[model samples]
Target: MAECPVIEADELEKRLGNSIIVDCRYSLSDPEYGLRAYLSGHIPGAHFLDLEKDLSGPKGRHGGRHPLPPPEQFREVIERIGGTESSEYVAYDDDLTGASRFWFLCRYFGIRNVRVLNGGWEKWVREGRPVSTEVPSARRGHFQPHPAAGMVVDINWVRRMGRGYVLVDSRQRERYLGVHEAIDPKAGHIPGAVNIPYTAVTSGRGTLRPKEELEGVYRGLGGRPVVYCGSGVTACVNVLAMKLVGLDPLLYSGSWSDWVSYEDSPVATGEE
Candidate 1:
């Protein structure tokens, strides 16, 4: 059987000492909130990774709000976090959003042995697992980045192949429907894209639904669907969910943010 990409809090607790645990808690509304939360308490030995600083690159006119950083820079960040290529990485967040992003980034860069903490930090705290505020010392790591192709699709690729693939919008129903948009300039989703809010893949407790359930949810979407969201962050949740059910979906990293940047591109409002 294939290795599971999601690890429970108890499973993670046992592997904490050997694996490189990453605390990916973050707030889109308050960028510093994640760091504050991490400083207050985190899984011992886990390093904090910032979404804007560590995961994304500078926002250009076309690359959307949070473009991925250069591959070399990402590798450097991994090494700084004391992660070697061979290190078993386990990432988590209060919600699964940030944790999924970390998992996707590592996988997109071809780093295996990385998993997301199933049920996330809330479950850990609920279980009365140990937490710490002290930061860990940096250790030299030998992580050589080897980015894998086909895992991600840029804006150009989305425009070109979107018609041929099932373009899935992983944003909330409201966002997908253009009911309300708080961050981006425009509302609505890409033309012809179907909405499948990432939350549907998770249970009421915020943990992923069973594989059989996920398979049922993704049924008839066709194989190798392409997924995206407001920017490219929460979309990882959908991508991760698809992986949990043995499906490999491509990520439209630029997502709606990039799609709207082009004045000529079409946008659809309301349910399709």
Candidate 2:
């Protein structure tokens, strides 16, 4: 395929019936809800991949909630889900964070033909395009994945947060503030991380807000940046969003999950 920049919902709508579209509107925090939403209706020919179950491997005390699956296992998932050498994949969600995780996984596995659906499934439904209540059964794809090293970072790298490094958080204001304490044990955010929240960067059409707007947000941060969320996944979306704005960001793979797990790590509460 050509260069895979983010594509508009209209552009994706055109390819839906004819292409391999995956509805990745999953919540590791709420898998059942996401699946129920998908079962109710989804883009025709679209398949579903849950972030916790399908995209990520089993969680461990050290691996965080949505740790990356091993390459061989991920390759199995790719083939099982109909991802092939010839298959061009488009992943989307009502929430870009979930969709972006799949996109980031595709990149990490060196699957080059994948792209994020601009505006995602929510935009598709609003436009009155075709949708299906039944999930389609797909033949196994012949695709194999090669893992990329530079795409991920570990805890040691994350500890080096400043200097030339920038850290971004993708949680909402409420959750970031430690006001909401439902998910992780600790509710506060990592000290020194800026709150970007992911959603504020998009337009109504499901595409990114203009590059100028994004540049202003990144430049406002004033340095090379690293992004994170409750886990490492949504943070990747923030990085991808920044990529749309022409800003290349590093990934804090452990993210807040790892941050909070340690007793001595700094935590900040409340909105700023």
Candidate 3:
């Protein structure tokens, strides 16, 4: 069995100065704040990764705010940012959005030596870790992405799920139930998909639960799970959490947004 992709601050501290600590904090409302915080102070050896500028490409009709960067492009970005085939990566964000993106991308690309900071940057700063003001000079490295087979599924692929794929919606309950609409124009979820909001995968304080707890929450569903959100991005958080609990889930990249865009797709509303 493989180890999970989550690590604690203390465990991370023991490896400091000898490992790659990536800061994935960014705000769509005020993007500059993350960079400013990095410039002011970050984990002593941490490298800052911008969500829009680094992890994702320009949004198009097909993808959302943080679509996965092209493979070669991300291979280069990861290497240029000090990631190597053997490097053990620790990614963090004040919030998990950015860190979760990093976690998913690395896992998707086949970078195996990676982990998410359980409580992210807020906890790091609170622990009084050493900080740095100097921008890092990256050393290019070799990164080979070995995406788990069937980890990503598109709209056409999802249409085949009765064959055995399980679609799990990661949106909030209200949105999943069609009572609320905020981010995406679509209000409901994919037909036959069960709800397990991304936020629920973690504690109120934003740390993942014990593997035993996660196993129970997911096993109760009684099937292999395929995770999805409005777009593909946030769904990775759920995937990462599943991995933490020993479950491997496929991601539906073209999630609710893509589903609703098609005239013939089915939609379901109301709580079950």
TM-score of each: 0.96, 0.90, 0.91
Candidate 3 lDDT at 255 equals 79
Best first by lDDT, ranked: 1, 3, 2
Candidate 1 residue-wise lDDT, 1-272, digit = tens: 12688998877787778889899988888999999999999999999999999988788999888887778889888999888777889989977888899898998887888999888888888899999989998776878888777788987887788344899999999999999999889999888788889999999545998889999999988646899998899999999999888888999898889989999988899978
Q: Choose the strongest candidate by lDDT.
A: 1
**For model 1, which pairs clash?**
none
**lDDT per residue as tens, model 3, 96-157:** 76787787887778777788889887787788977778777876788766666466777788
lDDT against the true structure, each candidate: 0.87, 0.77, 0.78
> Which stretches in model 2 have alpha-carbon errors above 4 Å?
204-207, 270-272
Clashes of each: 0, 2, 2
Judge candidate 2 against the unseen true structure and give its global Cα lDDT, from 0 to 1: 0.77
Error of 1 at 102 (Å): 0.8
Candidate 1, position 15, lDDT = 74
Q: For residues 1-272, what per-residue lDDT tens digits would candidate 2 score against the true structure?
A: 54545777777777766668878876554659788888999888888887777788777887577788888778887887778755678888886777788878888888777788887887777878788897788888876777887777777777765587767888778888888967788888877778987777877635667778777767778777778888787786677778776676777777788878877777898755
- Candidate 2's TM-score reads 0.90
